[model samples]
Target chain A: MSSQPRRRRLEVEQIGDVTVVNFVDRKILDEQNIQIIGDQLFSLVDNDGLRKLLLNFGNVEYLSSAALGKLITLNKKLQAVGGRLVLCNIDPQIYEVFEITRLDKFFNIQKEEQAALQAF
Target chain B: MPLTVADTMNYPRDVQPAVAANVTISSDPAEARRIQEEIERHLQARHVSEHDIFSIKLALEEALVNAIKHGNQMDRTKKVYISYQIFADRFDVQITDDGSGFDPNEVPDPTAFENLERPCGRGLMLMRHYMTEVVFNQRGNGVLMSKVFRRNDNGKK
Candidate 1:
């Protein structure tokens, strides 16, 4: 029997000088998001002077503290260098999290992907 | 079939009611979403409100992940158990782990000025904010939290 398909999923891609990570198939972001984002950022950190780390949250429905923690960690890592983390197309519920934590100030959040890419 | 206060105090022997709803997620770090959904389903079945469900789920996920990653040392061999007890006025949850316990006092405050920028350290804060009462049982191996659910309709009571 083919084992049940994997439960959670994440997508990472290189768009121009920016690394666009799309978190998909997962309604919630937790430690999994943290580790994946951390690994992706770390992998791209030294090899490239990343222009922007665009987080496409179009598919993610929920964001937990554990996931938020990773975002904070990623923001700091990118900020240490000249790079910045840009977020776009976040769902309203998920957006509230950024608003509550005041992380919106720390992140360059745009309503559209084009705006995020242009910000870089 | 119903879980009693005394029943909650001790781990189940034959078929632990908590284990009945237990979800074993991966340490792959990518499976965090599954954990949240599982928690939400469990809470919803117990009639938790939509408004409060997210908080309970997030807090529970934080505690569970802490047990899976930090406390259990990310050992996949260990399991994190979550159980629920429905009281007349309140709902309670107990999250237990196989790892050794630690002092909750040592957990750094996430809202503190100096630690504001840190990524972690906010789990317990989120948990406490969502639940009405939070207790760390002696030995600190697990956490028992409860919230009194007031029925707005008032017909059942």
Candidate 2:
């Protein structure tokens, strides 16, 4: 087995029992990086046993449907393991995408990172 | 003859060609990215608002992905053709692919409780939500989308 560390697209930090993930300052998230982001988030649950997560979207301006799909997939996986995932700091314009798809109701969305961390 | 990017710029904003380049690209994601970047550059030059640009960019990405992934089925031999036009107040795009198309009516509603967990179908939903107009060709192998800029109360176009 090769022992090279995997390159991470998401910045992950551990805060008490919650894992905070900050999306890179990329304008768009689509097929090109969805898998990389997904794998990294999944590992937080599968390998690190970190179930409670806070996803920060402060830097992301646009999110493609594929990226939304990946988020749904990750949310389901985390739920299956009795974990929770919350998102915060979504751009108002980007939040409209969630509202349009009615995904805002499915995911726990907070206006601030502190609120999201406190919600857990 | 297809209109080139240069041709798009020469015509007055009101008389810009309705059909932009009808580009044919292989089923590569990089090609999709290139086309998206070109469209972004064009929109930026036109001074589109950041909010409007984000919406258009997301909608365009969904259309391209649908055409390349579902329409072409990731077959490198297949090609996706995209046509777009830019105006001072509106941007229009259309994408066509070579694969067998599916009925848009049959796509499940992603927002429904039972379907919320599914990862697919959100692309079409998003396109319809973001664009001012969204229309699929009769065969479902093609899509045309447009976004009109929102004017303030000043009545500016």
Candidate 3:
């Protein structure tokens, strides 16, 4: 493996037992990047064995369906393990996307980070 | 003011909308991003409304992804042709891919409770909702979409 560390797709933090993940990129529209994000999120559970995950969308400006697909999969993974995945700080415009696809109803979306921390 | 983007779809050759920012590229995500940013820059330079820009950007992102990934299957050998016009009042773009097309209607309603968790198929729905017009060619490999800038009587966004 190359000694150089790979660029981080997510900035993860431990808020109590919840893993808070903030995106490093504003636009989550790239395919390969989205795939990497999914893998990293999966490892947070599969490798780290963490239960509750909180995704902070504070840095995300735009995200495509591919990104949504990853979130769905991550949500499923956490559910299978009896854990929870909560998303917070989504931009209103991006929230409209979830509303349009009705994913807003499917996923646990919180208006603020503090509220999201409590959900988990 | 006379013919809307929808009405001109079936008009004679002379009725076609004017073209701008027309280019073709391989099914590369980087190229797709570049073209998307180029159009976004044009919209910014034109003083398009923030709401309109957001809508256009979302629609364009979904459309380009569909063209490059689904239409061309991310094949570098395949090319995605893009033609667009950034009018003062509206933005229009036509993206065509060199691949067998699929029917947009065939896509299931992702909003349905059962399909909500599917993860895919929401791109087309968002595109239609955000764009003023979204029409695919008969072959279904090409998509023509438009976003009309919202203007009030005072013209203040």
Please compute DockQ, using alpha carbons, for every candidate against the native two-chain complex: 0.28, 0.76, 0.76
User: Whole-model Cα lDDT per candidate?
Assistant: 0.67, 0.81, 0.85
| C-alpha DockQ for predicted model 1 | 0.28
Could you say which candidate leads in lDDT?
A: 3
Candidate scoring better on TM-score of 2 and 3: 3
What is candidate 2's lDDT per residue for A59-94, written digit by digit as tens? Answer: 887788778877888888889999998999998888
Compute fnat per model: 0.38, 0.88, 0.81
Predicted structure 1: lDDT: 0.67
Residue B57 C-alpha lDDT in model 2: 85
Instruction: Please write out the lDDT profile of model 3 over residues B68-125, one tens digit for every residue.
Output: 8899998999999888876656787788899899998888888887887885679999
Residue A66 CA displacement from its true place in model 1, Å = 3.0
In terms of TM-score, the best-performing candidate is 3
Task: Give the per-residue lDDT of model 1 (tens digit) for A33-66.
Answer: 4555556556566566665789898987766776
